[model samples]
Target: MDYLSRTKRQYWIVLFVCFLIYNALIVGLWLLLHSLGSHFHVANDIALLICSVFGLLLMIVFSSIISKYLIEPLKAIWQLILHISPSGVAVPAPNIDSLKTGRELVANLAMQVYQLTAVAGQYGTKAADSELNNNFVANKLPLPLFILDSGETIIYANIAASDYIGTPVKDLTGKNFYMVMDMSFPSESTLDKWLKDVKANTATASMSWERVRLNVLDNHPTRLFDLAAFYNKDNPQNYETMLVLFDHTKQYSQDDQAVSFVALSVHELRTPLTLLRGYIEAFEEELGNEMNPDLKDFMQKMGATAQQLNAFVNNILNVARVDNDQLQLSLHEEKWDSIVESAITNIALRAKVRGIKLESHIEPGLPTVGVDRLSIYEVLNNLIDNAIKYSNDSKVIKIDAHLTHEGMIETTVQDFGVGISPNIMSNLFTKFYRDHRNRSQIGGTGLGLYLSKAIVSAHGGNIWVRSTLGQGSIFGFTLKPYTMLAEEIKNSDNKDIVRGAHGWIKNHSLYRR
Candidate 1:
């Protein structure tokens, strides 16, 4: 039998034995009283009544002693044991002073047992408290965090995650991660492949999704989130995975709206600027020889200013297109010399106005490149223009092109200018970022380099700048060389087949020319 049940049975047996002894003492006293009454000639009724009263008084006294010395102390000890049980309650220590010596020994033994049990349970209580603290911290965090078991089952989710998923925390537990997320990918196997790559440690365990709908309910807004997964090393054989999510929905929306507004406003301003430039060019063309030299120069300056404004507008439009993923390119095989000449000719007027000499060095027999000709021309123009603006007292600007050992064409535009500082260089190509030191000294919309970087990246290349603060700066980019394969395709008579085979060769081009 269990300890509680055996103890209860023993208690009942003790009570029964006490009852029998009390009754035997009462019966013996009554018999003796009756015999004394008969010897002393007293009434039998009076003797019986007296014996009954004495028996009742004796029972009451014995009951009070048992309850005070035994029952009450035992009850308190039993309550203390229950309090220290796994149920996590607290009870006051029992008072053993009211008990007689032998009963007090039993009470002390019970108290010792309670103390030992409390010591044994201390570690478990601490562990429980630690877990409670961890959960509290996780739930209080702003970002959503989830803990998954070895089977990719979500064992725990923070309050933010539960709110994001539109489910209660208890309901979310035991759900599979993929089912809870309900991710959509380009192809059916894309998610599987990504998971496999993450598990195999062949790819980064972080990913982002645009316009991800967290809830299955209709009309739910989509959000962008950066999700990262990491293995929990606490258990080696059955490790857990921690998933964290950061929301970027509001930021992306604000950026999109800002870019659209700038693009629209700049597009509207371009029309009047174009008309002003046309009028200036017409006036110069009609009265150039007959007009005074100063007047001619004034007209020329007006034209240059107009052209600069138009270029800034174009940069703004290009930035918007790139941000919206609407920049389309018409790629073709073009000779490096022809592309370079066109870019130089376009920027020659600006370079001459700044008194900065333009120089070029092209390695002989440099292979033709597959690129969007006009886009590359814009890149070169922006770099040279930037060089001319920053060249405080320097006069020489060099443009060099050569074939790299990796079979790619590398082009560099070096200028003897007030070079960029290390702090500004890193953020030079970020959209809408202006160098605080040069913003007042030089006039620019800060989108030129950003557009250049975007154009180069679209051509499957990279662009970077190197500079020493007082010396000079060099801007360089690499492009894939046009191969015999491109030549064969260009020479082929099957135009329809070429159009069908290549997706990048679409004719509905929207990019700046």
Candidate 2:
């Protein structure tokens, strides 16, 4: 039996028995008085009858009045006991003077009960207010909090709980927790068994749980959070589970930014160093026979050191740009034939300067390709420049442009320069991943290819290299088929006109997105 329910039943039974005893006493006193009146014959028969009737009526009226006053307060007490909400209700107590002589003690007892009830109500109100304030503060706290009863039903949750589940607090309550995205718990039997074991094993036992991934918001990829459950130290009847989110997305983004910055910066530095290296080599060649032979060797070594430094700077800068997502590709509509011609024309001087011949073949009437003009220009420059740098003197470097059946515009840069090694091909797009096979002769920052790939990707294109260690390399990328922005706007307007029945689904997508 429930303790509080059993206590209430006992109270009511005791009150009923007291009422019966008091009524019985009143009836017994009346009967005794009547018997005395009949036997003593204090007056004639008619007088006796009148006096007895009067006495009986008076006694009945007084008993009824006393019973009414006393029962009213007792009934109020019973109601107060039954009410769960702690609203103030004054117990209608009896005035001691209004009670019959024999009922004065009962009235006094009733007044004392009323006073005790008032004091209890005051304390209860203070405690409830304190608890409410604590709950308000707890709701705003960062930690995910939940309260559950022995039946495993969620009773309360804080604001962090709403965030963790990706819903408002009101909507979350009464819903089965496991139904929410990415939250899980042990089976009921398993949890109960574990609790039993923990209670049996030691003074205290705790185990760290694994991290759980949950997509707390729509369209976002899953993120990790640490979850833990423990026994409530102050209340053994309850258990609490807490969750903490450790955001690692920003950490990864920062690392990428650092790499991209290093790549771009190094590439920028190399351009100046390359110019310096060329001057140094030219001076050394002119002064070679006139200066001491040993001095000539020292100058050659210094020039070589400068060349290597320039290459190192370029590779770091290119890789950094890729990682940081800072590689910008300015997209625009441009004729494929014209863009190809301009790209080749710009790099033609560099190829000629390097004693490498330049060749170009562009398919006529190829539809305009939407691409970042500046980024594509750099891509062409880097590929052609690298070809000239590594090619045997006066070797040919070819550039080609065409359209694919899949509505893609493709561009390729073919170079006969000492080709990329199979082992180093995968690392070519990586920052500062130099091909050490040509380490003895070639010099570059190794960032050009990395940056080129990153730029191509930003323009919604793909880039790859085809090569063998000693043959040549072909670097190519494919851009998406171009469509005018005007056409896109036209399609959007048509979608608006096709509303009504289909509008509902379209509206959902628009709002959801």
Candidate 3:
């Protein structure tokens, strides 16, 4: 039998025997009292009173026995364990030697209990110190790191994290992560959105973002870095989320600022470019009758070249504006068809120069669109210009506008060009992005498509592409109707409507001159 069961059975047997003996003693006293009462002719009430007093005295003796044997030992053991210390400084051992009976048992038990407590306390202290040291090292490390609890609040941030974020440790702790970081990405997919998606749908996940820009609201310059996220759904370490940052601001901004400076310089060159174009047009008009055939062709070429330079300058400035987040949209209700016609007229000279014909189609009675005219014009120009640059021995570049069943204005620029590879689609709209293989042969600053995407997105539209190698490519976009987009903004929960699943599905494009 088990130890507890055997001990429990023994206890019952001892209690039953004691109960019988005590009852027998009571019977004996009652018989003795009755005999005395009869022999001495004592009153029945006096005999009963003597019996009651004896019963009360027996209870007091039983209580004294319990206190000395059971209660006293238990109290001494508790105090023994309490006074024992890991440092080996001992207190008086409860004076168990005074118990007189089983003094050896109580002393031995106290010694055993004290030994167990001393051992446990030492190991516990060591483990606690190790954990404390680990935390101290993490806080002092120069690498930026932080931990987040299940609530997405910042539970802990290292010193480096506080320095990188320009916030103090006390200020950062307990704050929601999304509130502190004003983040933007080259793609619509962000760190926070990915975190939510992983939490709801997966057991564990890891995600990283490259060239993640951290926009600072104060005097500090914006920071650029690569961010990595680590997560576990069931973690023993307690924290559910951890993020580490690798600051690459110096390297990334060095290249970007240098390019932005040169691009901004193009803003100054525009006036001279306009004068140059004006003079070229004047020469063509004044000398039209006197010039020979080859000379007239040369004049036409000069004007076309000037127009090309103007387009390049505009692209440079637009790209800089998009990078700096300075591009603002002034959307007006306008005729979608008229916009298309104007685009064709403006880009016709470039198409003629490239030996490519411009073609256009518009579904009749199309609704007006909410758009920024000049930026929309640039979007069209960039798309068609890209088609023209890559139109490998192709003839016609077709642009069409039609109202879709979804009540959005849809447009596509189709070209029989050296079709885009299945790869490189995701990065087509990234700023400063270029396909290295075509760098030598293709001439462009790679800003056209990126600038186009930013503008199209600002207007609450979507851009996408479909391509097959060695055949042709079609770049398409959609614009919500003016009334519908305005209504969406007014009714939007946060007063902003962002493209979620659809916007990130397509790549950005650029102009190649």
Candidate 4:
């Protein structure tokens, strides 16, 4: 197995054979000279001296020839082995055909060694890859797996695959996949199309799928998987498809149970909220004629609580609508600044009642964003509402809007009231996530910020928050600007519908809307 042990043994055998021949020839010459030269002593002595010198010179010449032809090539091979990296492999230099002798056998042997070295290097790489893949399949994977080649042949299957196939993988391999497994592969599906496209353009694609299945071990539970396949993204060869699967039967049952629970709970809560609002309205109406001032104030507070409950129910409905894709945007181009001013006016009375100051810092030349005027107004209203609710008396809530370099209008609502903790920042945009670490004294359904973030994102923009506890918070969002096409313009009369009131710049509208 070791280079020196094997090569040195070969060199010793060759040297031994050469030594035997040299000894035999020397003995034969000595015997012949001893028998023929006894009669001519002087002449034989001179001839014997010449023969000894000639034999010595000849031994030196033969040794040099052997080193050049046999020993040197082996030494070069040994050097090549030493140069190999930890992987036990190297890319051999091009075959030195110039070193080859005219002898046919020598030339043939040299060519074979060159070819074998090339093959050996490739084998080393494949061996490493095979070991890694086997480890990954046995330890890392939680589900059964198989990789298919372009011809739909099973190229690699893991231990899970063997367990799922109800037989050892070796038995299933080389068997036409469709013949062994009674399943249908759609010819018109994305998988087939991807294969064709890859062949045509030599580009990779991820395949879409609805379902897949596998046979578990005999007497074991059979498995059905929802699956998707993608071309091997990392490899340039793209010779295989990576199949991902999930147990859909379990997931489907869980979804069914969740739906039933939500349906029952929503029904139960709706009845109580409806009754509370009805009673509050009746009490408020009765309070209009009440003589007790304390009772009247209590009734007014009850009315406000009832109104908050109503808003909570409305938020739930809106979220449900969005989840079901039933929420429609009545998009129109409207004055950007005018919408902000209108929202400010609408909330001015509420802000004053709460003893909070509302202010705007609009950029001098901010462009309009495409949005449903009412939806954008709702987003601003929630931020301002929360600011006023959490702030102490005389705290200022500043709303700023400006045009960004990428043509988006960036709007931020800054509140220098109680800030949020970093741990809770991630959950702020999630539905019904209340930051109860502080500001527990304030009231909300916790849906306001969540709904506002969703609405802004749905408009092809992003919303984010920056905050440090005990410092302040900045709730910011970006929106793409809306531009009216030349053909959309009619007379100023028609333009009034798109433009906001009081010379307000048109904010946003969709092209097709």
**lDDT (C-alpha, whole model) for all candidates:** 0.72, 0.59, 0.76, 0.63
Q: What ranges in model 1 sit over 4 Å off?
A: 1-263, 484-513
Stretches of candidate 4 off by over 4 Å are 1-310, 392-394, 484-513
* Total clashes in model 1, counting residue pairs 3 or more apart in sequence or in different chains: 0
Regions of model 3 farther than 4 Å from truth: 1-264, 487-513
lDDT for each residue of candidate 3 in 1-513, tens digit (9 for 90 to 100): 353354355445655655676677777888998998888988888878877888778667755654454455567766665555444556655777665334566566665654454345334442232332235345656788887888888877888999998999889878998787778887998887888899999978988999999989879988999999998877544467889999999999997887768666885787788798889888888989999988987777777778777787878777777777778765655678877887788788878877789989999999988776678888988898888887879999999999888889999999997787888878888877776766887778788888889888988899998998878889988997888767644553422322111121112221110
TM-score of 3: 0.45
- In terms of lDDT, the poorest run of 10 residues in model 1 is 495-504
Cα lDDT tens digits for candidate 2, 11-73? 456556656765676566566657776898644565556656765776676667556644654
Per-residue lDDT tens digits for candidate 4, residues 278-308, read 8877876876686487676666566555544
TM-score for model 1?
0.46
| Per-model TM-score versus the true fold | 0.46, 0.39, 0.45, 0.39
Error of 1 at 453 (Å): 1.2
